[model samples]
Target chain A: MAKSTITFEDINVTVTVPAGTRVIEVSEKVGSGITYGCREGDCGTCIMKVTSGWNHLTEPSVLEDKILRENMAGKHNRLACQAQVLGGEISVHPV
Target chain B: MNKLELHDSDGKPKAVMLSERVHWVGSLDPDLRTFDIILKSANGTTYNAYVIRGSEGVAVVDTVKEGFADDFFSRLESVADYSEIKVIVLNHLEPDHTGALPELMKRAPQAQLYISQKAQSMLKALLKQDEMSYTPVLTGDRVSLGDRTLEFLHTPYLHWPDTQCTYLAEENILFSGDVFGCHYCDNRLFNDHVGDFRFSFEYYYAHIMRPFKDYVMRALDLIEPLPVTMIAPTHGPILRDRPDRYVRRYRQLSSPSLASEISCDQKTLLIFYISSYGNTRRMAEAVYAGAMQVPDVRVSLYDLEGGEVDPFVDLIEEADGLIFGTPTINGDAVKPIWDLLSSLTVINIKTKLGGVFGSYGWTGEGVPLVEDRLRGLKMRVPIPGLRVKLIPTDEEIQACHDFGLELAKELMGLRSQKVLNFADLA
Candidate 1:
């Protein structure tokens, strides 16, 4: 399985995991930041700004997109629980 | 059966029977310290799923949180097989109630999902399954299952937009999703047998249901006529004894008593103002003096320059009328005034009287902009906005006073005549 690198820019921490790992799982494993509520995309608590390598993440699901739009998030923002890594380096920051 | 026998003789938790055909197939999380990262659940909580067995098939109303899937499935299997589930009712699309849905749908692939009409897109998004088939239900929609019937009441925004209530006709039970639910978890399945949960009940309503009080009232109106003997909500103890008391409490909490208080001949008028250079402050004082001339109208003035808008929200919601005074900076109203206007979204101010008075240099657009926002919120702007140049002259100050007086008179007339239009009564 291919590996993906995730950089939490705000905390200056980086982690490596399998390509298909959800960003929420990485945050939980790190346990430093990014508070969560509902884990599903219904709540916008886990919204993160994709600072770099945005194409390395999966497309936002309908729920994630709706919630992100509701929160007035920009195109670079994605829900940590809804977007999975696609085998590349992705840098993000919690909004 | 006695309440103490919630567990088997071996002391393991078992499914409790609500009626001959309705079983409480839910999971209890007694160690849960918090919910949704906001509410503190010291008494823990329960994900109350119910199983209804008809002569022909079975239906499941709601499911537990994702972590409790094993317990939920064990309890569910104790009453009915996974293949027997013909219907799955999603009372609310929030994850606490629908977290186990993916696994449940996989096991009970034959079950058809039913939700409120507003919940279609939400269901698709939450389940991440756009192709999932579901029956959209309205207020009076009903689905028959042999000898029993499941009726849906479209009660949206009890806390979420996808919320609805399911009533079981044969058992006289209301599967109220989160309406009368609490976060207190206990082994006692029924409210009659549980300890005092008054704090938990009120805490749940204050934290979850308070923001949508108008919807709570609307939801109450929809369920008022039902002969509901039991209220099985998606959380906490089942209200099997005098469930109407909970409904009455909701009604009392949601109903604003300010209107009735005005009927006793005392009405409140709030004047909020933010003045940059004492020009708008003079105009606000004139407006306050003018409003003070009206009989039985209590006027309170607040300067918004350095004050927070939150403390005045309840007062603003209860006031009979409101006047906003602002000093135009550049081409718009001051930020404090805009902040005050934005805070109105959380409260119900639909038909209240509103007026705007401001002092601006050249544009004088601040007063009209504030008036437009008040009108956009569905408030009644009986009089046009009052605007004066940089500082008000004596005559303009009197005009500001008269603006306040006329608006107060309009409010009094509306209250007295009970008419939507002031001109109609005049």
Candidate 2:
């Protein structure tokens, strides 16, 4: 049970979160502006680009991975519900 | 094959009701209406898996999709005798209909799998995974329900290869698969007590069976002679009350489309967004400039200006592809685009592709934001989407060319893809 601090770009607000938390939930908590619908891991709505810390995030879910497989994931994108932050400092853009 | 789950005292067909073994779980995409979401969000689903009680043996009919195997089993345990299941009647082999086959067979080893001959081969080709078992039945194969009779009718083109319908003469029910079915879910099992069956049935016919209207017409002709009181589909509520009402509706669907009511085949490109200063509109026009290069791609753009609440379903119906453009609003997409996205709850369009374009000053994911909303509609988008910074650029225009070319190919297929292979089937 490890927790780590995550940062948001614009506001520079950081919050402690449990390990394996998706950037989406983190963004939601800090109000970092991510749009998402169909949270069942299909719709690529909650996708975010791993700008700085891709390693801190777990691999995307099968649905997200499928989108990537089809080469449709937005540039540097991953679904937030499916992506987990192993947590450290990470940069995410809600693309 | 049926082992006779229920029978009248004089050896006729009867049950407290049929197949107490079935269960329905929550829908995967409630927001997605194709799965006919009812009973808390499992869209367009009945999750039908029935357990039969027989004198000599027991069996289950159909199964939930792989995603809902756990749910199917748990629900089966509540009403039916699961441990004694002897045979599983697989009327069709669509993955959604057969997703739990392997899991169910493994758990109930004693039960024999029963499927139509065509369905057996289709299932083999479909569930190509090894270690499967089944008993094949073709037309006239009668499965005894102790004293009652379960008859098999081979309906090859009932939406899929090797599809068939099962008629339990004793119970006077026809377990229809994709045919004569709709995409709506309800807690009530019978159609008699249910709300509007009109929409679900029409949607199913229009979306799934509209193209195959001719065979459906022939199929209707074949069923005219049978005195069926109940029609239970794999999706939506069972029709026990007025089965003919649904049948008449199906008949009308098979009837020829009037020249006036025929949905226009004209191509449409749906562009969605909000432009503050005409910067995004310029980029969108560039995308359109590229899209128009391909012949016959009619296009429409929505500014979402002045709080327009128009859902634009006709455009959704017409478009082969959708291109979205939006500038950053507050921290998310402009409220207008968000409002449009929210209203797009039901899009029966399938296999449509898309693109996202935008321009903004110090943009915080403007193009990506709109693209995400488009993806929620289940439309595919080609890679390397154009995202112009502040205005359309040479590179953005180049990206636009690629998007148009990719969409043009897909639209070409819709126009020319010989979907009417029924002549060969017949």
Candidate 3:
């Protein structure tokens, strides 16, 4: 599987995350300026918008579907803690 | 019909946008007089649905009834597109909240449904959507929608087994389902905007939330640690400015120690009496007057002659002392007094002071029998059966009053000595 390049546009940072890696973990490795709470998706602290490549992220879990359904506005947003990289490149923007 | 026609002619929304990301997309039934053929809603009601817009997804917290589908969906559309909505959370799966679910599902077909683990079968059965897919969330479960996370807190028996509350972490908003809801419809949308809703709020509490006081306390304890800035209940005005005020009020209402007047420096005495020919009633009146002599004691008198036993049973659970009066007939207490005493034995009445008095035409076995029942229930009988032959004279009535004072003294003595004991140990 190819590594997915995730860019944290707000912090002007980018990181190569392997497929199936959570965006939150990748952000932590690259030292992105994203805040988080209750990393299990209970807290929407690490919510981020995907500027591009929304489908590159893995399908949200039952919990993530609810959080996104409740707080997010568009299809291009995902919780960094719960959203895993599937393939291709993705851009992350702090909401 | 004209008013309704004019209202529909105007394409404006009755809903209010509460914040940058939150919209109060609920419907108001201003003429609804009753709820579920019970629970009087004099001020009508509101079925609240909220639209929360996160950076990447749009979610609807709950939906209104089917009759108000146009109003609910229009209000929802005023904020966001239905097709764009990705998820719908049913904090409570009651029909009033989910009446529009079928229609909502049809319109927002892309949206996934979320309900509590316990509500899965019920929701499916209720909607008859056995094949529908839904995510069953637990207490600490979390869902993320871009830059926002919504946490579900399982607070069962806020009147239902499958009830839960949604917590928006970034906004510090608690969509508290039915836990803090009242059947009030207001366009104002918030506690600060609405003036003095305390009466209806408490009324709603007593009717809907009172039976679940234990769960109320538990739910309060669960959310105590969260930085809750707003309480957006599925009904009535949302608590945004002072959410803690409602939470604290609920805490005071549900605390077992604060259930009645006994929590203060006062004790409550409940007197149950049956007077066949005004004799036992007179003795009960004397007991009531005598008990009132104590500065910090509350007394409630119930006539067993014509009333039901259930409410008095609730009073029995709260009172610090029990006093029974009966007119002895055929060597036993009147049937009503016996009925009251029998019900007392079935109840787990706590240790408290007990007093019994009676008016006897012949053999006065009734007073002793009442006393025996009290003793059987583990009550401390300070004043033994005060048996009087027929109606009591003025002097005997005074003695009956003294019997009441004895009970008050015993209660005061019990409380004061306990305090002293605790102080000494400390």
Candidate 4:
């Protein structure tokens, strides 16, 4: 399995994990301060900006997309709990 | 519309009529000393129920308390027969509103029950009738009885989850369950005819509805746009004389500014604590003072032991920063603090600045445990937990103050960063 690196810009920390790792998991591993609730893409609390490497993350699920639209989040926003690292480096910041 | 023949010998109407089609079929309890074991009802109260005759069938909105079923049934019978009742609307499931429900269902066996979607489980549990069936309604759902239409608005948590308001389309009357109601029992029936009840009205708001001010605001928003000529609540006199004034008063009372005088740009920090020996109270005061020192930050300090936690839930939900103070007893934080934390699950407090501070005699596990819980709830804790041994010295108090100041600064920094990020995105 390929590994991907996630850079938490606000907390100034980076972590490398295997592919298919959720952004929330990487956040917990490095204490990157990306706060989340429900952990199931329902609360819209873990919304973060995809500062770079947008293609490195998986597509948002239907529920996540609906929540993002309801929150009026822009195209750059993704719920950390719902977005997974595919295979490349990604950089994000909590909104 | 004026039918002078309907008046009794004394000029008082035998049946309280709000309009040509709607009638007040409710019971008055002028002797009620108290209500729900908390509200002090000096002038007693009224269980306001209404009967809407729609040329085809009748719809009954709510009922009196259990013991007053006879009064409710007699009034109901005067306007329409038990068989004529086609729809029963339960706006709220509280006992005072639904106490006569079991009997009413028995008499009006063919009538269908309508309630908010959230009241499905509550209906079965409250009446202890597992087989009871009801049509769950939503915000825009409506039911027609020939000519008149009843539109439901899902205005929940005005005080209870199952709470809702019904609008009479033709008459423009809002059958609000408990909102804009008081504990005053008056046979005059209408707000214009009743004696002064401003005290009871405000008192009712403070006791029953104040705890859920955020929801009150939400409920107000839902009902404000309607062309309501009258507000017939489940309690107190029906508001037909300038009903909008009462609605405006509810809007004023539930406004966020009434809780704390913080403007939109300003931040709010809340410090909640429970003290067994006044130690934690002192610590909370110091934290409040420290947080207040920061410009554009409003601080509120509450002693949880003396007050109920429900009122603070909305305040905390709107706050930018929160600090919990406790006195560790038997290796744990007090029950009130834990109760308050548990209640936060219903609201999203994610990324809000959180801190834990307390005074303990021996083990200071209370502070760290709360901090861990806050972290689990997704709150951004900027600093470690602060603990003081037993009573705090002058230096220890200073440390507590510094803790609050640091947390407030971090909150301010986060707000600024958010503004900058939004600007960049724009």
Candidate 5:
């Protein structure tokens, strides 16, 4: 129902996505630079830090939480494929 | 356009400073392709080496590939004199790191070569130099370099049995060979500059370190308490800004969570047996009876003698618990048991309960050996292996049954399921 602005800090790119859009899909639409392998949460290829608007993203699944918790990624970090736009501006730094 | 110039003005390889006296002298294969003939290295790769200048003498941490000898030596010579290089520390004996070792040993003939105890025979066989003398180092072992101290951590199977991680006490830098490494090659040589190398790092782990996850966890735990400011791996960019991140990533990747994710709902138990004289087969039946005593657990028994009578492998993959019954032959488990164990390694057995039971004549080492192997595969062993000598007595058979019950209880505990006591149900 709402739009969220997703900014890719590394490439200085940004795109607008509807509520609950995955970060990987946003990156694909805007040609934002985000390297990924296996796209699934298991491989951890699309790990990215939410530089801002952490609360704007959707909740992480059990698998994503497990992997992120394992990698010692902070609350600000979320796998691009797993984290969705809940509805606000979110800035990301791919790790 | 290499940022470090680890090469002189005229393109001759040179050493670049990492901190003050610490230098990076490893060579880069910009055009090189694959790594270990398995993983694809699209960005090529780097054979990282380090030169630490202590107050008395210098120490070379590792070497580059053999084909890059000229470049490697040039870089080594650019920073310190070969004769002044007092120590050559080899964290691993893999060819990628030891390819230029023979030439390096020839150049720095007087330098002491340091390797792990497990590496002694492996290095000899790998280099084909049986008589070469090496100083064997172990976990917590230290070799002083006048002002700085190099401590060795015997972290085996970080990819190889002989692998070790070297820590520099003064700088608090850990020379972690292949432990936190990837095949990523770039002029930007630090995690801060490289942005995110998650894919390359994950790919490296999937290909190289997946089979030896247990060791990876052990190494992480072993190094967690150290005041490590930097991680200089044998490949890719060094982790300086946030070395802890990589360590945490390793812990996450190696966690049993990945293996346990297979998700089996039914409590399955596999009892496989090989009978030399029917004694072990009887033990298997006794254990199966005990396991069947517990409710809701699906039990599958397979005689591994003829091999193809049952789909033991398919059953093993689905089982939540495993029990092996074997006859000791010359103080060892039978060949089929060994073959089955080897095949099980390729399957995910983490978080599963495992036990060994066997019949022995002169030696009872077979069960214990199987237990050790199962433990090595990261299986949870809830009870000591049941070993019955010769023909099992009624008491011995009961003991095996009790062992099986204990294993079943442990499995229930692991899965956090309530055991259905027939008395309580009644």
Candidate 6:
């Protein structure tokens, strides 16, 4: 597994993540700054805004997109577990 | 929230907003703690009212609660200066929405109360009037205002047949009487304004609207293509936040997946029995009370004498849990307990969980008999059957609520087997 660097805009914290790690997983490794429930993505609690580095994230699941378009998802948001980190720099605004 | 800020679905500001002819001077029912068999978070329900500011003449849509006629009149006063109105549209003949009709008509002597054609005879029968200010407009009927128009879609059995929804094309707002309503009474109206929005919508959908599945589906299909930006129903907050989210939920409830979707966690049904002079009934209730504390499992209480075991049998046959209780008899089980156990054995119905309860004068008879019966039925008894000689102490009752929490986990392992609404099985 390869490690990648991740950053949060609100907390000004940086963390190293292994390859194939999801943004949601990276979110958990950092701390309780993020809120998520039903990790299955049914509940719309874990959405966040994508401030930058969206290209490094996996495509949003169908349910994720639906929540985002409804203005229910947080800023530039993507489901953390659903969106795997792809060995690149990423920036996110916690919602 | 600004009224003009409310936009049509096509991203246009509401160029035409209906006049405030009708006002919701309705009261909330404090006693209505649980409405339509579901617990309500909102303390009470409000009556929705609208006034039509027509180019020809003003029409008040509906009135509020019984005691709140003055407020409705005040709202109507703000909409139009005319003391005499032209038409008063009665979308639904239900009392809360129509309670103020007589007084409203008296105030507006020139106004005719409009109702559906199907509802025409029903209202006349209810009101017992031959020439009361009534106008019967059913389907394909149009009420035109110089600036705007109201088209009636007679929604049959969507709660009520007289229940018709009006569409304002120029403003693109659906004066949907009650079809898309919540029980909210907050001043902060609209979807986005209400935090924790999904629960209210689900409560309305699951309890109030779920029963009328077919009519709801037909109604949804009819409006799916319409350019609806805002939905003002007869109850709850106005859907100005994000109308699409509520609309999508309605669609999901109506979709075919409703039959197959297992929304609850995997759990077995828990049936508890309770009785008073019927001591066994107490045991049944205690067992049920116990199982309910458990999460993820469904609990049902059967009274050997009080409850009919036949109707709830499907819940029993498919459930992974079971409980029985009865009062003591001449050192023997009560007749109903014997009958129920015999019925279970005859049917060969079995489950993964089981328990028993009973009261006795000299000694307990029901609990032991119940255990023997369940064993004969080949039903699985995971926990030792509970026996109470006389009445249960406070600890005994605590045991019941606690029992529920434990079985909830056990039942969680059982899958929800379909008894109805399955195509292949059907």
DockQ category of candidate 4: incorrect
Model 2 whole-model lDDT (C-alpha atoms):
0.62
Give the best candidate by TM-score: 4
| All candidates: TM-score | 0.65, 0.46, 0.56, 0.67, 0.56, 0.48
List per-prediction Cα lDDT, in the order shown. Answer: 0.84, 0.62, 0.77, 0.83, 0.80, 0.62
lDDT of 5 by residue, B193-260 (tens): 77467888988986788767788889988899999999999999889987998899889877754246
Query: Would candidate 1 be rated incorrect, acceptable, medium or high by CAPRI criteria?
Result: incorrect
What local lDDT score does residue A60 receive in model 4, on the 0 to 100 scale?
88
Model 6, B1-426: lDDT tens digits are 433322347643222233333233334443445554444755566577776666777767767666766655655564465464777787777777877887777777888777776676557655667787676775567787767677777776567666787777767777778788877665445456654546666777655566566788888877777788778788777776567777788888666441243444545565655455744555556566666665655566655455676645534545666766666667777676665555442122533456665667787766766765664454444444566667777777666555555555545642232121111211
DockQ of each: 0.01, 0.02, 0.01, 0.10, 0.01, 0.01
Predicted candidate 3 versus true structure: per-residue lDDT over B332-416, tens digit per residue: 8778766666665323463566788989988899888776666545555645579899979998899889888777777776322
Residue-level lDDT tens digits of model 2 in B303-327:
6674466446545554567777777
Measured by C-alpha RMSD in angstroms, how accurate is candidate 4? Answer: 8.2
Candidate 6 Cα errors over 4 Å, as ranges: A1-95, B1-41, B82-84, B258-426
Off by over 4 Å in 4: A1-95, B1-15, B258-263, B270-319, B322-354, B359-361, B365-384, B390-402, B413-426
- Give the worst 10-residue stretch by lDDT in candidate 3 chain A: A26-35
Over A1-95, each residue of candidate 4 has an lDDT whose tens digit, in order, gives: 78787777654556767788888876755544577789999998788889999999999889999888766576789999999999777888777
Query: Could you say which candidate leads in DockQ?
Result: 4
The candidate with the higher DockQ, 2 or 3, is 2
Candidate 4 pairs with clashing backbones: none
In candidate 4, what are the lDDT values of residues B265-358, reduced to their tens digit?
7788888898888888888888888887788777888888778877788678678888999889899998899999987754557678789999
RMSD of each: 16.2, 15.6, 21.6, 8.2, 21.8, 21.4
Q: lDDT by residue for model 1 over B1-426, one digit each (tens)?
A: 435454567655567899989999888899999888668998799999999999878999999888888778877887889889999999999887898999999999999999897788777777888788889999999987889899999898888877999999888899999989999998777999888899999989877887689899999988989999999999999999999999999999888877765566878899999888899999999999999898988888999866787778878877878899998888998888888888776567766778899999989889888876875565666566899998789999999999988877776773232212111211
iRMSD (1 decimal) for each model = 27.8, 25.0, 30.8, 11.6, 24.6, 24.7
- What's the true lDDT of residue B243 in model 2? 86
Q: Once superposed on the true structure, which residue ranges of model 2 sit more than 4 Å away at CA?
A: A1-95, B1-86, B90-111, B115-165, B169-172, B177-229, B233-238, B248-265, B285-296, B305-310, B328-350, B363-365, B368-384, B391-426
